[model samples]
Target chain A: MRVFENWDTSLKIPSMFLLMMSMALIRDQYLISLLPCVAAILFIASGLPLSLLLSRFRAPIVFLLFVSVFLVLFSEGDALVRIGPVVLKSQGAILALNTCVRVLSVITVGIVMIYTTPLSGLSGKLKRMLIPHILVDIGIMTGRYIMVIGEDYNKMKTARKLRGYMPGKSMARRFGVIVPTAATLLIKGFQQSERVFNAMRMRGYGSSAAGEARSYALERPSISSFLMFLATVTVSVLLIVLEVTVETA
Target chain B: MHIPDGMLPGEICAAGYAGTAALTWLCIKKARSSTEDPARIVSRASVMAAAFFVVSWVHIPLPPVSVHPVLAGLMGILLGWISFPAILVGLFFQAAMFGHGGFTTLGVNALSMGGAALLAWAVYRLLNRKSGERAILISGFVAGFAGVSLAVIFTGSVLILTIPAHIDAGTEISAILAMAAAHLPLALAEGVFTALVARFLLRVKPDMLL
Candidate 1:
């Protein structure tokens, strides 16, 4: 876990993306089945808490379960089992299993990437990767402010509660309160942004020469980082090759 | 709704990415040409995105259940061409921080949600030519309702059409219709909320409505 944490974001981001894309490309049921095991091994190796992963996994897992149930019940195929006027088809079961495994594996990789990499570092890496400069800047600012605005929201909610405000059973009444609160927040945010922009302008932001000077200064990867990146690419390529071969055969 | 990874085939995902890239490029170009100060636009959009993210946590209670508003319509009316990039940023954070959405399906999710936002913005602008608070409220309601409805339809169609299942065409169409029908109530609720907020903003901070 420490090793992954210490890895450069430039290398780590692309490697994880490649790993996820490869996992997505694998379609064979057997190959797809192996992915969850691989993901488990990766999870154990990362040393992240099981509870944390499970909590992150909860929503997607519930969704997958719903999808799997629908597939098993509604999909057309030979019956594998009969239960109280319901038929479980073998093909549906296989499809469900494949879908569940594939989604879990991809999600696990994403989880690992997010947990291991710092968001600040990730944004910097994205800027270096030739993404639109304004977009990346906006992303960074948005990331910084989500927590701040969220805290403001909490305070406002608490204040409302203190003032004897409670969302009643009536939906119309609830909207009347909630919409005003949301609008107030938006106004606050807009005012704050105007101040922020003024401050940034005072600091010489949006200077064309300065912007050009800062864009896309690519850094060469360390030997270890390069080797890891190479290994990841090789694995991803191999996975695609194998899948293509199987499909063609 | 955000589609999780591995739900659709890789080809569809790839195509989604391609389409998103093109749209993002076009939006950025539009934003750059339209605004005088790039930094100000970025800052404003970022703040608005954060506010939208926080506001989405506000629960709307419907008997036996509740839902968070997507706010894509409000976003479009407020941010204009920048709404797509703002949404993309918000979705990215949602996936990274909470694992609420999918890494692989980010492009598709953005297209469904952000594309709906753009449509809503166009509708609002078109209907808002008449000057008055009533006009603003009516436009806001229509945009909000249209935004959620289009997003639901787009997401449902994509899921039903691309899902690797053996269901017949009739069943597939039925599933898509059912999904859209189930979301109608939520769309109506969003419309009312948007209209109310638009009216409030018009009274307090009239400039913010744009």
Candidate 2:
């Protein structure tokens, strides 16, 4: 856990990205299945609670199962199993398995990357990676205010509930209630933005290069971080090579 | 409609990133060249993006189920060209905060959703030449409907076309159609919601509409 947390964002971001892309590129079922095992190992190494990962896994797992069921039911191949009037094809089953493995592996890697890294470091890393400064600044502000806006919505909902506002059964009535609430939120948000812009101007934001200079300063990657990044890139290249070899065989 | 990571091929994801980078650069350039102060634009767009993100949490009951409004069209009508960057920011926060989407698929998701917003904005601007309340509501409804429908089409096409499987072409088409059919109700709901909100804003705070 400390190893990943201590790793420099410069290397960590690209390493995780390569790992995910490798998982996506692997076509052979047996080779693809190895990734989830690797992800499990990484998950355990992260030292986060098993429940946290499980909770995050719940929605995607359900979605994967739904997709897999569709593939098994609709795909064409020699019939592998008979259930009443339905036929499950061997090809469909393989496709379903491959899809599940690939999706799960990629999702697991994403979860590990997100959970292990501090988000505060993300904007900086993105900037350093040459992402647009405006996009990064907007991203930072948006991240900072999602909770604030969400809390405001909650308060408004509570106020409405206290004032005997009931969401009726009809869709029109529901829209009636929702539209006003949404309009008010937008209005407040617009007004708040003006205030925020004024405050930023007062602080000399955008008056000079200082605003750009205030971006998060990233630390240089350590030797160990570089080695890990190299290992990740090598593994990714090997996975692609093996996938191509299996395909050509 | 957020495409999860691993659902797409690495090459497709890479292409998505490439396309998104170009579009984002264009948007930033447009924003910087605008008459409005760049900082003010960013501040307003960011805060409004946050507001829209919260608004999406409002669930509309459709009997046995409920759906959240994407509000991409409303965002387009309000934020203009800044809608794309605001949406990109909003998606990033959603992916990071709740894992609702994947980091690798960010570009694809942004393009689908943000592209819809741009289309909506164009439609609204074209139809909104008339200076009447009726035109505003009608254009708003059309924009909203078009936005979500286009997003659904883009997402369905991407997912159905890109599934690394042996499913026949017939099955793929049917799957795409099925996905579109499933989201039709949500699209209609968003259309009505956007129209009503546009009308409300015009009455209370007209400038906020654009």
lDDT of 1 by residue, A1-249 (tens): 786676677787878787788888888876787778768876887788888888888878887887788788879989999998989988888988898889988898788877887665555577676676778888889988999999999999999999999888887788878988999999999998998889878877767634553643545667877786787778778878888988898
Q: Model 1 residue A241 lDDT?
A: 86
User: Which candidate wins on DockQ?
Assistant: 1
| Candidate 2 residue pairs in clash (backbone atoms < 3 Å) | none
| DockQ comparisons of all candidates to the true complex | 0.77, 0.74
TM-score of every model versus the real structure: 0.95, 0.94
Q: Model 2, A2-73: lDDT tens per residue?
A: 887877777777888888887887778889878888778777877888777677767667767777888788
lDDT of 2 at A244: 89
The local distance difference test score of model 1 is 0.84
Q: Can you give the lDDT of residue A98 in candidate 2?
A: 85
DockQ of candidate 2 against the true complex: 0.74
- The residue ranges of model 1 lying beyond 4 angstroms of the native Cα positions read A83-85, A208-218
